[model samples]
Target: MRKISYNQYQFKVLLYDVPKKIFILLFLFIFTLILLYINLEKSEQIAKKHERLKVSESTLFIDNILDMKKDDIPKNSIFFLDTTRMKSPNKVRDLTLRQACSIESAAVTNENVKVFIVLVSPYKTLDQVKYTPAMEAILSYKNVHVNSMNLLQFSADALYDNFVANGNLLKSRFVKQHTSDFVRMLILIKYGGTYIDTDMIVRKKLKDLPSNFICRDHGFLNAAIIRLQNNLGKKVGKLFIDDLIRNFNGSEWGWNGPLMLTRVLTDLCQTSNVNEMINCNGFHVLNEDICYPINGLEWNQLFNEQHASKVLQSVEHSYFVHFWNKLSQHEKIACNSSAAYAQLARKFCPKTFSLCHEYF
Candidate 1:
């Protein structure tokens, strides 16, 4: 090869370094872009995300040591609730104080939601659900009291919507032993907010209970989680009452409330398609889990062993808890269920099961 001059050597070295410099620059630029994309994704979703609140064993430990007392309800917030008795002859597991603690521990997990309990009872038996000191203290939320007018107000509606004065007159009668439940939710319209059942405690703060629509445990919506716009909710309630009364002859639709509400609101989809009706189902949707059978084929209500397993498998996550029906399942796995659930409960609330006594 011909000998190269010094100037050419210097130029060659500079040329050689150029590609290396470009490659380094390119790698750094790409890495920076990836990081930017990640931050952007998180920032965009921050509003919808739960803001990452935690409820762990540490909270439970502190709770056990601290003698937490019920602070006086400073606000005179009117909760138009029908009262419910704590223990019924039908209930299988004794809903003891330990259960309350378990429920309380479950509740504290959610920072976004404040539980609201609506109680409906006979005018005379109001005290049954009202003065349970353990419950009152453990419930770090609001409670509402209402009258069920009659025992049949909640369950007899579908049967009597046509025959009786109200839409669910007869069905309401059957379920109305806890009438405040159905009726007091109307107050959510005028009162403006969410209705959290006493039976349901927070396992976590659900950032989106699918806010655009009310959610059901099943694929469809249920009434247990009623989300109504202030004035709109009141009107829906009034219409339900009036329609029930007008159809005094009774509706054979049976006592399925969430379904009936969906039926009642079917008119809203007049111009829209059937799918549109489904989209708007949230307006009158109920908590499908409570409304439908847990083990059934209802896709939204698919909760149980399978549901929990799937959740554990997924890192991004979906669904939580192995909720048991107080009235439905008994002579079964009440004390002993999932080891994960048992351990989780024990880890978070050691006294919950421990505090359980055969009081009821």
Candidate 2:
């Protein structure tokens, strides 16, 4: 063999080491890839845990099941009024003493239940609307909640389309009362709670009442104090709403109000005899005594001074007294007097009774 130079020998040695160096680099690259994959997996697991924690934080665990607790839940009683429907801010027609009495009575009587007053715009909060002494008293209660809902702001979903169409179509001919009936139904269905008329004065804790129930007034099933559930009540509400839209007859006075509900009840029960309690799909059609202890004809006795004793005695066992404000709205409640309305207001709504002189 010929003698090799030192540079040549070094070149050969370098050539021999090329394969080992490439193997080492390949191993290092593979190891780095493995480490990256392991780190990515750990990060992914942490992200999943964070998402689960967020969900757990937002949802409420009731009876071992997750339930979304919205602002409308926990057995609330709702009242609707159009004080802010068509008026300037702060100059709107404030809730009348009678209305305030009704609200305050509910707030005081139902200490365990939440009372909500749903007003129409341009009122957004309790502060924005004109506050009467009675309203202030009711608002001061811890269980009372005030909300402002606009008819135009209502959702236009399938149920709402019929609702909106029926309301807007009847706007030119019908009064705000017609639209209020529709709103009450929609609210009860969507929120699964109670809807009480502004003329009603609650005399008992409504939380103990059945979840899905309606009352009858003067041989007719009424929606004055409607309490419904989320699941089945939603279906019933949708049915009534659709029926109103399908058979909207604005020409008649109570067509959309009582008559529509009567027709729906008739169809639901397959009988026209709603004079007594009728149970339909766990929904109770309660007797008038539960809400309307005094019928429409007897409604005048509530404000009659001589009938004060009789009215108080009559509503002793009643949960609420429907004053039939439509007819009695013109009647004035006397302060420091022995009238039935006066007596009831003083007992249940002392704030409104104290401020009665200003309104009278």
Q: Estimate each model's TM-score.
A: 0.49, 0.74
Q: Which digits, one per residue and each the tens of the lDDT, describe model 2 over residues 1-360?
A: 999999999999999999999999999999999999999999877743322222242221111001223553464555555543523334444577778788888888877776667665421332244444655666677776555555544534223654454445445255456667677776677667888888988888876777778888878777777877768788888778888777877667688778888888887877787774488767778877678889998988988888888888888888999999889888865576677777777888887767766433
Model 1, global lDDT: 0.40
Alpha-carbon local distance difference test for all models: 0.40, 0.69
Q: Which regions of candidate 1 deviate over 4 angstroms? A: 1-106, 111-114, 125-137, 140-173, 177-181, 198-201, 206-212, 216-219, 244-256, 271-308, 311-327, 334-351, 354-360
lDDT of 1 by residue, 241-345 (tens): 454344422234233454555556666544222234545433534343323334223222212344545433431232233333344233222344443334344
Clashing pairs in 2: none
Deviating ranges (above 4 Å) for candidate 2: 1-69, 83-93, 122-127, 157-159, 162-172, 358-360
> What shift in Å separates residue 212 of candidate 2 from its native position after superposition?
1.0
Count residue pairs with overlapping backbones in model 1. Answer: 53
